[model samples]
Target: MSNVYIVEDDPVIAGAVADHLATWQMQSRCAKDFEHILEEVEEYQPDIILLDIKLPYYNGFYWCMEIRKTSKVPIIFISSADDNMNIVMAMNIGADDFISKPFDLQVLTAKIQAVLRRSYGTALSIHKLECGKVELNLDTTTASVDGSQMELTKNEFLILKTLMEHAGSVVSRETIMERLWGNDEFVDDNTLTVNMTRIRRKMEAAGVKDFIVTKRGLGYIVGE
Candidate 1:
């Protein structure tokens, strides 16, 4: 199931989006902590985001800029600010689409499905990964927790992908090294450590606590 992250602060609208998506068997997460919107995005790492322009603290444009620095995942702006300037600004900042507030769920769902099919379905694959309630962005190599986005390096993305793919299994260091070695000109051991550390830091910031745990001589495990 594809996860949709809703950044709207209004409880009613957020609930409506979640309910609408659920009918299609599509899962969605609403941002509960407005104070840390990006953090929520990082945890829920939805396949796409339904962002509101007017928000607490910094507005949607600010968050959109922050998200652009990390992932190419689609972002659709939602707000009462329906003027052309807002729409133009949204598009200029890399927003995939814009929908004014009080939208019809059916229409919104159509748009969501269309965007998802265009952005991902055509790729000939589907994947789902999460750290607690947070979703991992397989396409952009990032994670969204509590509406916050966390950027992952190429190697860090790989390590997280490896561990996420085999959640409970202890991925051996040698196995990890082999995977890294096959990439480009072969990433060294030190490079792997750096990537792991970076990924762990990103994970920690998402409120994941201990995301990757060392298994002594064996290797690493994602789920404890």
Candidate 2:
């Protein structure tokens, strides 16, 4: 799972965003210690950061510059200052994206997704996951086994990716559904079943056998 750090000091906004991100299976943490922003970044090692412009002590631009000195992780500016100059300055200072204050949660999530996709690779952020002879390339969104390869649909790729992330652990069905649908709230159980079945068929076709295992009442697991 990708980790996102929220540098906004506003408790309400930070809490709401973190809660919404959780539904998408993305981990997030709000910045509590403004005095040690860089230290927090170092310890968290977040994949991405959401920064606010007007902050206590140092501003977002300063923190962004400091972060850029050591890491290439994506930084997105979120603030009430929506002037063209501030936006331009943010981009010039190394922010990957910028969101104006009072933005929709969906818009913020979309921007986050776009930034991550550009900073990292495609669908799956990490490069590849391997189990025995089978390999999944996150950038290409394809699974390969024994020199044979097969492309996976979006849902199939996510399902396999989730399983591989947990590996030996049994990922619950509810968790998988939340990752797949986010807050859609209307997904049926049969949809996930169909996706899992298709993933298994694709793996088999690509020369991979028994790659994903089902656990009676639990969800799925990749590695032994």
Candidate 3:
């Protein structure tokens, strides 16, 4: 059973989410010390995290950043602050996905399951793949170019993996979207764009140049 750590301030919502997760055969632990959620997260070492934006002390963004410093555990933000800016900010800060407030429990469950499947499931047959001089470590969800390694969030890793697996061929936007979110119906198109931009930025920072080529009106290619 996958363990989920919920850092929601609202007791009612946290309780509801925990209960729903229980029905899905998942174990969850709620954060009681909002001021020191990082400690709780460390102690729990959950497979995934459900973070809320509005909290008692520092807020979810701060915790997300702190957690990203050492861990690549998938985080999904549940917040009423679901504006485009907030969503984009969350993604930029390393969140795997964002679900707005007043959401259906079933939808939330599905999202959680999808994220877990991607993060933990053995979808890739090989442990690593290479694009030019850059190497993607599937087991670690990180890439190294010229010996400089960069970590990737779940979305970034998935996008890069798809492109590398089909190296030299443009993987269409729709195909990538389907591979990332299981379908395009539930996710915004721009989210994929944001993930792609971040992945390219990370690659560039790690000494990789022009690693992903964008073919206008088609998709992206890793090589050739």
- For each candidate, the alpha-carbon lDDT, in order, equals 0.78, 0.85, 0.86
Top-lDDT structure, candidate number: 3
Could you give candidate 2's per-residue lDDT for residues 1-224 as a string of tens digits? 77999999899999989987764557999999997899999999998999999988999999999999999999999999999999999999899999999999767877887788898776545467777887777646677887688888868877877788788889999888887887777888899999999888887777677888988898778787
Residue 151 displacement (Å), model 2: 3.4
TM-score, predicted candidate 1 vs. hidden true structure: 0.54
Off by over 4 Å in 3: 122-224
**Per-prediction TM-score to the true structure, in the order listed:** 0.54, 0.63, 0.55
lDDT of 1 at 166: 76
lDDT of 3 by residue, 76-163 (tens): 9999999999999999999999999999987898788789878978542235788888888754668888777888886887788888
Highest TM-score, which number? 2
lDDT of 1 by residue, 1-224 (tens): 78889888898889978975664456888887877877777777788999999888889999999888888878999888999999999999999899887788767877776788788875523444775656776545567777688886656766776777678889998777665454355555677777888877877877877878989989999866
Whose lDDT is higher: candidate 1's or candidate 3's? 3
Query: TM-score-based ranking, best first?
Result: 2, 3, 1
Among residues 3 or more apart in sequence or in different chains, the pairs in candidate 3 whose N, CA or C atoms overlap within 3 Å are none
